[model samples]
Target: MTRLNHQEKAKEFDKWISWKQEGNKDAETELIMRFLPLVTKVANRLAIGLPATVDKEDLISFGRFGLLDALQKFDHTRGLQFETYAMWRIRGAMIDGLRENDWIPRTVRDKAKKIEEAYTRLEQEKLRTPTDAEVCEYLGMTEKELQQVLYDTSLAAMVSIDEAVGEEDEQKTARHSYIVDEMTPRPESVAEAKSLKEVLSKCIDKLPEKERLVVSLFYFEELTLSEIADVMNLSPSRISQLHSKAIFRLRSALTRWKSQLL
Candidate 1:
């Protein structure tokens, strides 16, 4: 199907939504067909750093539930675009499904926590982004051993930053209110979001050059860790270590910033 421009697409969607609201099965099917590409796009992007054992098709299958849920729950009256709302629902559903499956082993999660702890301690002590060598020394491991641990813990690290920090329902509601709002966001929420972006930018900018490049390529460029490894001429495991360390530093910085705000 040819893509419609925004105006044309919105009008078409309004028609389909109205028909579906009136129990039109054909309209519902059409909406599903139209959103399938979005489901696939989210799944593919998320699957990048996931372990090889995870099936991409499984993420897509999980994402369909999110799409349907978004279609049912989304309020056009809220003035939020379906695409924006559906993207979060889809990604959240996939992560929830992965958690349900307990895909990351307990040991890997422990190791990832240990790495984060090292980052926190070092940053508090030195007030700088610790180099990979420094982190390895802090962990009392060789560079090769650090790489192996990183490979084992990569999925755990990726999931932790986005994991809910409080009661599940409350976390979901807070995230939705913060990221997806009803028409215009409250001034306070807008200010909080701006502050968060500024803190995150400064933290990322302070990363070691190679680590910064890895973060840039993976998140901004949407490149896989292996692809970034190729670009940097390092092993994929090394790239994962850099990615993990970068996230740890950012999380620590953000935590400290939030504490200072209180």
Candidate 2:
């Protein structure tokens, strides 16, 4: 990759197009074989907090389809990181399959419900990310107690990306629909998407300093909780607390922004 000059980059993309777009079976197989581990990795991350009844192997299988979809649709010429982009596709596919199987454990739902509702309502009323103190007071808990609860409940909160995706026959929830990967979409849709991205950017900027950094390091850098803790000079449990809070705040912002976007 370091040896690739500008023209060589174009050549590389051309090769990808010929192999992937022009039906080179061998190339497709190689691509899948190379990225099979990535699928497994994504599956493992998503499989956290899932039910024992939900087979981990099934998650890997769903992620394989995500890898295939990404290979077909990804633009190597765009100069984006394939792993980062494919993570979204892989996760979306895994979540889609889980929903199809109705694998959303009711226990997770019940665990998240009271906290999510309280957080959402507070954010709406305050029009900003609520403080841990504020949230704890609202929920009738102390700081020490709330920290453990947030870390323990983080899994329930983290898996809500596009969790409300409706079927083709049903109306979709625009708020949760952030993963917009389409080839050759309409001009209006592209403009609208850019605007929505701007809104999301502003929302992230509005998060508390620590929560924003935690979000960036976790999602954009793909760092683990312990790694992020090392980077931020905080405990892994602290990082997790911030992560859970950030997700909840972002979801609340999306709900408020969706009304205007629609």
lDDT of each: 0.73, 0.68
**lDDT, model 1, position 176:** 22
- Model 2 scores worst on lDDT over the 10 consecutive residues at 175-184
lDDT of 1: 0.73
For residues 1-262, write the lDDT of model 2, one tens digit per residue: 1355789666556667778669777766765675677887777555433444769888888888988888888777666656656766787788788778866567656756767777888877887777878888988989898777776666566666555433342223333334233321335456656665566678779889998897777656657666787899987767777877777777766666667756
lDDT of 1 by residue, 34-92 (tens): 88788888887676557778898989989999899888877656565677678778887
In model 1, residue pairs whose N, Cα or C atoms come closer than 3 Å (at least 3 residues apart or on different chains), thus clashing, are none
Q: Highest TM-score: which candidate?
A: 1
Clashes found in each candidate (C-alpha, N, C closer than 3 A): 0, 0
Q: Which regions of candidate 2 are displaced past 4 Å?
A: 1-24, 40-62, 69-85, 96-104, 162-186
Best by lDDT: 1
Candidate 2 matches the true fold with a TM-score of: 0.69
TM-score against truth, every candidate = 0.85, 0.69
